[model samples]
Target: MVQSNHETIRMNPNIQEKPETLTKLFIRKFKKNKLAVLGAVVLLIIILSALLAPWIAPCNPGQTNLANKLAPPGADHWLGTDRFGRDVFSRLLYGGRISLLVGFGSVAGALVIGTTIGAVAGYCGGIIDAILMRFVDIVISIPSIFLLITIVAIFQPGVEKLIFILAITSWTTTARIVRGEFLSLRTREFVLASKTIGTRPSKIIFSHILPNAMGPIIVTATLLIGTVILTEAALSYLGLGVQPPTPSWGNMLEDAQNFTVLLKAPWYPAFPGLMILITVLCFNFVGDGLRDALDPKGNL
Candidate 1:
């Protein structure tokens, strides 16, 4: 027995036998996708610009300069002045802060609520699962955009309100995804072993099962951020979101609705629209990359 153990240790070098951590493995796999890497870079730049808006923005995003109203891109006013003569570039930077904040906040709220409900329903099974899934079905039946519009119209439109509405509406999908994951994971050997060893149900569900299920949850959350941003933009475009002087990309696009501005000053709307497109695309790319990286069958 001692010789067998010695032989095994000798055959498997200590350095080579060390297990790779999930984070490191994930990073390695993620780096193999070029588009995802590019997306990550662009996302980092956008986030940094939004976070540093106060210092980086040339002029006050809210301040108006009648003299410079409708000015095209120039040395003094990069990306030009808006109809109100506010710096387009400054507003763009400041606008990013609000857009990103709403997206992140809404998705985070949804993830928490969805994960908890999904875990309970899936782990408990039977009547609980049926009720929870039925509720999910009802919510899914409603047209989310219509619900959002009605809710926003009934209540005041503000950042906090928008985030709350989005969270309430968006969690259904996440719940479904997490429930499916839990249904499968609960039957796995590790989970069964934990239960057999007298681990508390709560501990087993959260500590063991949730971590294993996070691969899909994380990917879904990343994609959901893009979706929330688009929804916020749509609401703002309809004059029901973020309100003027707050300067989200959506409200900023409202200026383009004017035929005169659209004809004469194309740059006024172009920058914000481009930013929104790029932001959404980057998120999607990152999510796709994450899906591939996290999939067991994907190329390592």
Candidate 2:
């Protein structure tokens, strides 16, 4: 038994060393970043609050008590009531659910479409690459927000519609980035070797190329979430996103835009704006950390 084990170890000496994956290595580096840890904690707290909103919210978010309109923060209403007497605190909690959902959902859709398009373009090369890249450029040349507004205008402003608009507009960036990465990687020795060895195209693209290209993809996806959230707020503010009585962060700002509400209930927009700022900032910080951590050459 001992002789057989020794022979196995001799056959593959590399087996004695620890095998660390990209995710494990990235995690190790991420743990060393203080700002990333703080950002992660803040994000976790927000996610938990969103998940537990029903149990934690003191009052009904959509329920209106006209008599208590514009009431200042106190024991009964921690964040106070808005113009419609809906609890600001509760609305903020519920609003986060929609905002975060849009951010994640749109980005997920973008990743799927972008990865597939980019991989095909890069791996196939020639006419296919030229055509796909031109399409990407055409999409990129147009103003994203304007395009989104135009599309959403046709569909009527709602959360699902807004998500679709953002997803369609957002995929261009992902495709551009992924295409660039794959373009550089496709000409490498390993890819050439895989081709020479008769490896399947799908296997070469996903099993080899995609794994190596994921670092930048992940970083971009993280940053895209922040962008998505900000875009959703902008759409909502323009009355082209989440509709009334829905209690989104953007429309919450709309409620506070009135002079009387600004003076009487400053907390309405203040809380929502603060939440947006902090959340976006955290995502940006996390993205930066991820970029530094995942750089294969340690060039951060």
Candidate 3:
């Protein structure tokens, strides 16, 4: 027996090794995707820079000097001066704070509202489901951009208002995704067992089915953040986003829209525009990685 065991160990050194935890497995798989790892690193740096903007930014984002306006990139201003002569680099860092805030804040609200509505509708499976699903369908029929534009046009745009508007408008998609997941998961053996054992409906919905459904939710939320940032940018470009003196990536692009400035300093628009592109792409890469990592079949 000892000889046989020794042979097995020699053949498979990992025979007695403990299995990798889900988190470790996920991290390992995520790291294997070079683009995802790169995106994660770059995004982390951007986030940290934005969060630490007050301490690290060399100059105030709102301070302006007409004499230095439109200066090209130099030692004093890394990305050059905007039309207002604000340090482009400092504004970029501060802008990231607002953009990320809106992105994450809106997505969080959407997730909560959408998940709750979808869970109730899908788990109940009758009139409640019909009513809720119909509402979602109605909301879906309306163009989200038009709805957003009209709402912003009606109410003066601020960071908080924009986040709120984006959340309410965007929740339908999340609702549908969550509802589909719930519908599929509600009939599973584990759920049936829970029901049979007298688990509270709320407990079963929240604890049992929700955990299983979280993989899709997480991926969706990640993608939605990028989309929200883009939306905020568009609104700001239209002159209804974060107002003057308050720097946002969106309004930065708006500032760069002057015909003379665009011709004089292409870097003006390019800076914020590039930030948006990189941020969205990084988010997409990370989302793709998470989707793959979360798939049980992929792990196998």
Candidate 1 on 1-300: residue-level lDDT in tens? 455655777887773445779788899999998899999999999999999999999899999988878899999998998888899999999999999999999999999999998999999899999999999999999999999999999997999999999998899889999999999999999999998999999999899999999999999999999999999999999998899889999999986778888887987888999999999999999999999899989877
Better of 1 and 2 by TM-score: 1
Report the C-alpha lDDT of model 2 over 28-96, residue by residue, as the tens digit.
Answer: 888788898799889999989998999999988999999999998989999888888888999999999
Q: Which stretches of candidate 3 lie over 4 Å from their true place?
A: 1-15
Q: Estimate, for each residue in 184-258, the C-alpha lDDT of model 3 and write its tens digit.
A: 999999999999999999999999999999999999999899999999999999998888789889999999999
CA lDDT of each prediction against the hidden true structure: 0.93, 0.89, 0.93
User: Ranking by TM-score, best first?
Assistant: 3, 1, 2
Model 1 clashes, total count: 0
lDDT of 2 at 293: 95
Flag clash pairs in model 3: none
Which pairs clash (backbone N, Cα, C closer than 3 Å) in model 1?
none
Stretches of model 1 off by over 4 angstroms after superposition: 1-19
lDDT of 1: 0.93
C-alpha root-mean-square deviation, each candidate: 5.0, 5.6, 3.1
